[model samples]
Target: MTKAANFIWYELMTSDPAGAAAFYGAVVGWTIAGGADPQAGGVDYRMIGRRDGGNAGGVLALNADMLAGGARPCWMGYLHVADVDAAIAAIEADGGVVHMPATDLSVGRIAMLSDPQGATFYIMDPIPPAGAEDMESDVFSVTEAQHVRWNELATSDPDAAIAFYRRHFGWGQDGAMEMGELGSYRFVQRGDVMLGAVMPLMPGMPAPAWSYYIGVDDIDRAAAAVTANGGTITNEPMEIPGGEFAMNAVDPQGAAVGFVGPRGG
Candidate 1:
């Protein structure tokens, strides 16, 4: 099936927006812009933009009202779908559950969901996308604009999860990356470029979950930002077999995040 929507925005609902903002800002060299005013009940969020004016992302304040409403600290990415209603139906038919029904935001219509294994994401209609290219510009930076780029889900059952996305998102192409000890990661692609990787947990990992990546200039310094901002370094910066560098860290809210650079970001 055709990938009608692109993931344009990712809002992490976690405690400590200020700290989260600082962590991500330093890691990705992202500039945090003014957010919507507070008196209106909107989040004390920030617009995360690439340093070189490449692309823009978002951040939100995680609060008690959110957790009280069953919200967990997690990364929520938005998929730009042409028809949000149809996408919602497809997800439901494919064993996913809709946590929040289709709701129209100032941008477009969106519906939050969880895959059969509980990985969460949202299907939406982006407000003013020129096309996939512009949507990509909005979703991630230029260096990150691949056929399918951004969020990768690490699951317990890669094969089954791949089959699920194939049916649900109808991805046209894909390939696999062998992560020495972890296992072979089968990517769900929109075309030639990999949108995300479906990695099965190696051992002792309780459940399948999703992790997000942001392109940066320096992984070493970025990893340090995690610790500086009251976060924990899950994985130190290391050179992936290929020509890239990356590190994994836990945000203040305990959500996992990854920072990738061209060899040494």
Candidate 2:
């Protein structure tokens, strides 16, 4: 049996690449490399390096042409699939839209897509480097700092979104938390690893989208770094069921993100 698809990579599309690099570097303790000079004028793709020497993701500079074409600052994840074309077909048949058709790059074959409710993400069939065929991606982790710890989707339709993801990615609704009038926060999992949760859009959420939570060692210090670096804390840190605190914030360039860590006294 083939292994199920999982989110293997993440990228941030931002208008201010230099500023964003600085912001995330301070907040999440990431090292930004490449494309330091925005005025140099090329495809500005900066690699996000974790302290442990692993790459967490990348930051893409959105050009004027892209901005005019309706591109905005946002964080998108790449889901690794067995076949890119087959995944696109399955998505379209289930009411998802193909924003960018499958294109081959040095990294792999990838396509950008939006779900039935308009949450955008990418599907990739990666071509690993020579002698790295057996290597697994560690960009996402549940307990490690400086990695994506959770993937939450706030959509307009919870039931349909859950069903669609379940059909395509083999995600199971293992449990949920009742949120009074807001509805249930449904947790999604693949085998024993809890990926994240899906729920209806809250009152303050701008639209239907996926918000990724980056893990930090200290929640309170991370929140302070966000504001000090010109980012805005949208949701203050609050203790979750597991005793850790989760908070939401928008980057200096306006991309919404979240952080999960311990609230050190």
Candidate 3:
């Protein structure tokens, strides 16, 4: 990971990779290309808005024949770390488990981990794309990491979650916000910018699931695009209490994602 501690790849493991890529393209106006574009590669691995030959992300084909090891369809976030092995060691030492040991990729090494609370994510140490400069970025690029604004972990215990992150990454909690119905929402900041949240899961929800939010230019248009693209619209377009208009949607692969307009400061 030659870049800062920022998110790199935003992968979606789904039943049909091709269809998923098409769905995202229609909904987000992104030109799904690279291996994700079946015309470009034979494999099901596909990408959206591919340019500069960076390893941003793609939808992995998980059809019945392809699906194995009981991996459910979900949106996964991959952060660029300095060292894959070191990150694995830190994750396990912080009460996490190595869900997937370090695996070698053409670009770099990757490994998946789940915190003690069962929230799963991955870390990657990219090889800088051979002759390329770097794949990571300093500021969060909304267009690059599509459907990924912040990486939030809904832990069973917020206190323990904060402690674990602090011990592992030196990040601290930025305090909390109380939604009318969502109740208290704790904000976590890597340093100054609010990276994401650590909220309690809803009733009967899975324990400690990690989800990423995609920032959009217009919430209404984004939600409309979801339906137009053959994707399922989970939440109708609506304005939150603070004038934040958003809509929830799931790609063709059944990975839930949300699109929000400009967020008020």
Candidate 4:
């Protein structure tokens, strides 16, 4: 079983599920399948399946009720926890806020939460299917082409945000990169694996949030697909530390997603 405090599941809550499916399907090469989730009162819920086989994430359509309540299209990260209630208590004590209380579900207990610095994510005590391995083990691995490659946070207070997560998820600083006037980009780890980094939010960016990078085979091709499929490339493709190229984009429904891959012509 995968240990607690690791990223397990991902979800995109969008106003236009079909549009999101179409846009992401072309950009990331994911096949959107699956029917409505019965537990969700038969709301249209789709699975993002990778080309190599296995689910990457899910898409949940935001209905009129959700939109009326101010729900917007966004990608949410799920961090595994051993006890959702206990985690909630710790989070509250550490200046975090609960957007949704812990609730029972088919998979496990889950709660929507925002860290002290206001980056939203979920904490789930996931229940793997019968005869299956830990959900985290199957869903999150570097070798998988479509897996989430990184969890990047752009926040107003990186130091305080890193400290809050270090206490909650046992994430530690691995290294730091000086960004001159923008301050430092600090890498974070859960044990020995370097998951991602935290940096100060760029001016004019939306409120503090976590941006997940999806792995791809070619960065330039994916960026082009993003624009061609009705999405906007918010940032030009750039080289990262491990020789990978990456870029950020907004889907047609306005959800932010990142792509990481080799440079393409």
Each model's TM-score?
0.85, 0.95, 0.82, 0.94
Q: Using alpha carbons, what is the TM-score of model 4?
A: 0.94
- Give Cα-based local distance difference scores for all models: 0.68, 0.90, 0.69, 0.85
- Model 1: lDDT to the true structure: 0.68
Model 3's C-alpha root-mean-square deviation from the true structure amounts to 4.0
Model 1: residues >4 Å from true position, as ranges? 34-43, 129-137, 141-149, 179-182, 263-265
lDDT of 2 by residue, 134-205 (tens): 888889898888999999999999999998888898778889999999999999987789999999999977
Candidate 3 residue runs with Cα over 4 Å from true position:
1-4, 34-43, 50-56, 63-66, 130-135, 142-147, 180-183, 238-243, 262-265
**Root-mean-square deviation of every model:** 3.4, 2.4, 4.0, 2.2
Q: Count backbone overlaps in model 1.
A: 6
Question: For residue 236, what is the lDDT in candidate 3?
Answer: 80
Candidate 3 residue 14 C-alpha distance from true site, Å: 1.4
Which residue pairs collide in model 1, if any? Answer: 5-80, 5-81, 6-80, 148-195, 218-265, 219-265
Residues 90-144, candidate 4: write the lDDT tens digits: 8999889999999998788999999988999999988888977543455566544
Give the alpha carbon lDDT tens digit for every residue of 5-48 in model 3.
56667877888666776776665555555354544245567665
The clash count for each model shown is 6, 0, 3, 0
Specify the highest-lDDT model's number.
Answer: 2
